[model samples]
Target: MVTALRGVSERAEAWLDVERERIGLWLPVALGAGIAAWFALPAMIQWIGLLFLLAAGALVGVLAGWQRRLGRIAAVGSAVMAAGLLLIWARASWVAAPVLAQPAVTAFSAEVEAVEPQPAREQVRLIVRPLRRPDLPPRVRLTLRGDGDGIAPGAFVGLRARLMPPPTASLPGGYDFAQRAWFDRIGAVGTVLGDVVRSPGARRGSQPLRARLSAHIHAQVAGSPGGIAAALVTGDRGAISPEDDEAMRRAGLAHLLSISGLHVTAVIGFAMLVAMRLFALSRRLALAGYVLPIAAAAGALAGAGYTWLAGAEVPTLRSLIAALLVLVAFLMGREALTLRLVAAGALIVLLWRPESLAGPSFQLSFAAVTAIVALHESPMMRRFLARRDEALPLRWGRALAGLLITGLVVELALAPIALFHFHKAGLYGALANVVAIPLTTFVIMPMEAAGLLFDSVGLGTPFWWVADHALRLLIALAHAVADTPGAVATMPSFPRWGFALTVGGGLWILIWRTRWRWAGAVPLAIGIAALLAQPRPDLLITGDGRNIAAAVPGGGYALLRNRAGDFVRDTMSEAAGIDAPLGALADLDHVECNADFCRWRQGAEEGVTRAGQGIARGEQDAAARVILASRGRDRIEGAEMAAACAAADVVISDRWLPRECAGRWLTIDRDSLAQSGGLAIYFGERPRVVAALRAGDEHPWRQPDQLSGNDEAVPTDALAP
Candidate 1:
């Protein structure tokens, strides 16, 4: 046994020596791990967190004194990770802006900071800084009337509106907009109550330019194609119809519309290509040793401009920083699109906007690039893509193969993240992207650029027409693919632990450079299995406590609501993987349901399995009774309420119980549920609960008190954070 262990250690050392270059790539991973660690914690005392970081620094100092090669690597790697974790924690504290605690109606005078006009809807989104509310954060997002004319950035305006805290997750593991809002310093979000009384000069800020450009593009193009074009150029996505957007998402082409890394890379690449070509035309300039530098400078400038044009959102800014790093790498004569560049960009972005680390854009962007770089660096791929004077047909075949490989790699690399955030993954996204990417990158983008060039001479109509047609073709293809049966697969639930496992496995595989990398597949397999293993919740409650979904005795889930809008239905469907329409609670077979309560009968069928598993053998013949209440009524007679409580498993009313009501196993009332934002309850031997807002969570944006308000409508587009 001692000899075998020694042999293994020797072999590992040899492998490490051979793969020394790859070790540097893990530094960024360490940093990201640190940042992720910070976000993972619910709440930490500031001084305690700082002390932990200091301890980490001390660990690094002590570890660095070790003489062993492996010890050195561990010290450096762990130090990077600790730095990342502490850096993110510090950033959070630094940017801890004020957030509204609850929904409140008030009239306040404000200055228009920015105006985002939705030409399609003939409405506008006003970013304002309220003058009267000194306690409010610097910015608030409000939906208002009109085409957003007459309000400049500096123009003061007065308005009466009801402000609400940014929306939290509607269900456990659902989207959380409050986090993003907090990072953006948006104190409150709401719709303008009535007419806006403004000083009314002219709407200023970056929006006016972007809105005009978007409108111009829409005019040149038409329909959804025009919307796509405008989004591609100006990053104004409001013009795209919901149907088209859904199709894009289903087809896995939604990335194109987001003005992210791909668009930034393309713009920078094109700018560099143009500058290099112009310089190459002059032999003297090419020989002066300034050609590459000039080209890099041009690419950097274009990337920055494009980022600003795209609203300068964190995602766009992340891409810009990454692209700039690539340019810098090129100027320094290093490999431009390598893993190091990706890491550097990620580090810079994390330092600038640590909160973005939690967002899908940041995760997907970095993961995809890191995986792609690793793949291309492999010996087999390097040999495959090696340049040679080959036949045109062979070259085309090689390019096609590379594209397919890249798409599949990116798909696999990003699948866990996509599944974690969206609960869904595209089935044929690689196949669809094989066609869409080339069109967008080679044909559509170039045509759009040419149109802008020709428009300088007032002759760009034909180019714009060509670009519009190409965009339409892309949309048509997306629809065809999205509408196909089984184009998308959704998981009913995915726990954060599963996501962590998969991500760690992926990083292990990407960062290692030996047969040992294959070992990552073990955890990857386990994580994927875990994703499909989470039990579907038996009950779901909206944040407002106004709606409820309960699994029936038979098979299907039923809802208790006067009207379940498309948004609510879709949100529930996505979260639970219930494709069938939600049935009326009172209509389910063998279940006793009324306006105030529901009871799921035991053994309604031979056996009802969930997620392919049955309940525990802890025997019980009693039915599961879930009591619900309404808005108008809070309490009932003491004896009647006591009997109702005694007969069931849990009570989900808004805590309107009488004094004698005491027999229920558990009571989840409005105020208690409010602290959680929302929740999912799994009916079992002992009901398991998952809160949308985890316990001890004390993020700046979180105000659990705000989640308990009454008269809350089912959240929809109008109330979007």
Candidate 2:
């Protein structure tokens, strides 16, 4: 036993050492110290201390590197730098924490910055430049309410709104949006107070340069032939429509819609080619060496495109910096595709805004770049491509292969986080990218550029025709792809550990160039295994206070109460994976609304007896059993009825009552049934269930343990008597 214990200790120590080497143990320690300082020190002192610490640490790092023998010194400096970063982050959090904690209330004076209007619903986000509350955070984003022409992006308007945090819902075993929003720095979210009142200030500054440019481009390409033209140039989705979006996602062409690494690279590459060709014809121009610089400037402009001035969003800026770095390297006569450029871009972004490290855009962009660069340098890919000549067919094949390889690597890298954030995977994304990326990059971008030049030169007719045709083609492609079956899969949610494992493994595979680095797949496999091991919920109920739906697997369901709305029924149907005819439940001998007992009889062999007018029950004698009720019921009066249904494993009610009943009791009330703005519960024989109930349980179906603890009559309001 002693020998085994020693071996375990050694292994643990070695593992810790490895992690320390990779992440520098001092970073976490420093972060912890910074967190501590935020609570302990004054705000001004904290900021001063953090600034000094950063300067001192950076000096130490420089000195240590110069000495070459000061390993410990470098590590200590790194830790200090890490701690300083933490302090800065904590300080920001401190300033914002109070405003975030306050309940969202009506703020009449707010400025609308952006509007995303859908066919069914429109979202207008505003920058709440607080004039009355000067000490409050300067910029608070609020969503306004109203329909029609008054609201536009970049408009300052007077609107009232009671902002709340984003709403959360549990979809079986799935990701939680509320938690994701917290990490994303969204302090509060809520609906509009009333009809948005547009003051005279609304018209002023409504069309900023970027907004005007986006609008103009959108309008110019509105009648374009394909979806590709609009997506390639301006990142405009207004002309694409929902059907087109769905199609692109289905066919794996969805990445083209988002301005990412592929689009940037294509723009840069095209500019470089054009510049070199222009210079090749003139020796004097070549001698002056204006080609690289011109190309670099053009690439930067292309990256900036029409979406540059959206308040310096980290992801877009990061991509632009990376593209600029590549251009600079080319101008300096160095290999532009090195990982060092990637690292430089990362470091620069991290220094500017550390919070972006946690965002999806940063993760996805870097992951794709790292994968493509690594694969390009791989012996296998190189040897395989070398065998094919540089013909058009071969080039197209190479592009397709590159797209697939990069897409697969990025998907694997981002899958865990995507699932954690959205709870859905774009299964067809691999195929979509191969077809969509090439079409957008090679065909659409150049055409859009031509159209813009022509429009500028007063030859607008031809350019407009080309743009229209391109958009239509792109839309058609997206539609065709999306219409196919099984385009995406809803994944069960996995915790943070799964994300860490997946990302760590993916990074190892994509970034590490060593031969034996394939072992990274171990963690990747473990993460998937962990996700697959997650437990499934046995029963689900969905409603909006008007209707209540109870569903089981294999399309079996019992409705306790049917009201005016079918929203609950639709939600339940999706949750239960029911695709059969909706009216089939009526033919299954289920009970209809009656005067006395709400009941159902299954065939001739089975009989279900429910108590009270609103109480409902369904039982499968040889299999599972259940009891359901309407809005108000505590305990049934008839002893014979209780005894007759004594074998039931679970009893469910729309509301709770003060009564001692057999088996486990579930309730649907404000504290019991979630569908009615109440808590829901699942009671069983397990001790864990009892402990869970005691843990300040917030489900709508379970009564608060505090209420049950008192011997005095439960409040009439608390129980349905």
lDDT of each: 0.75, 0.51
- Lowest lDDT 10-mer window, candidate 1? 712-721
lDDT of 1 by residue, 383-428 (tens): 9988889999999999899989988999889878888888887777
Question: For candidate 1, what is the TM-score?
Answer: 0.89
lDDT accuracy of residue 74 in candidate 1: 63
Q: Per-residue lDDT for 54-167 in model 2, tens only?
A: 566667767655333243445465466556456445534543322243344554454554554322224444554433443233445565543435356655555455664434
TM-score of each: 0.89, 0.68
- Model 1 misplaced stretches (Cα beyond 4 Å): 1-12, 45-65, 119-122, 149-152, 200-207, 388-390, 552-556, 591-635, 703-721
User: After superposing candidate 2, which stretches have Cα over 4 Å from the reference?
Assistant: 1-107, 113-124, 130-156, 160-163, 168-188, 191-195, 200-203, 223-231, 236-240, 272-283, 305-314, 387-414, 540-551, 555-721
- Top model number, lDDT: 1
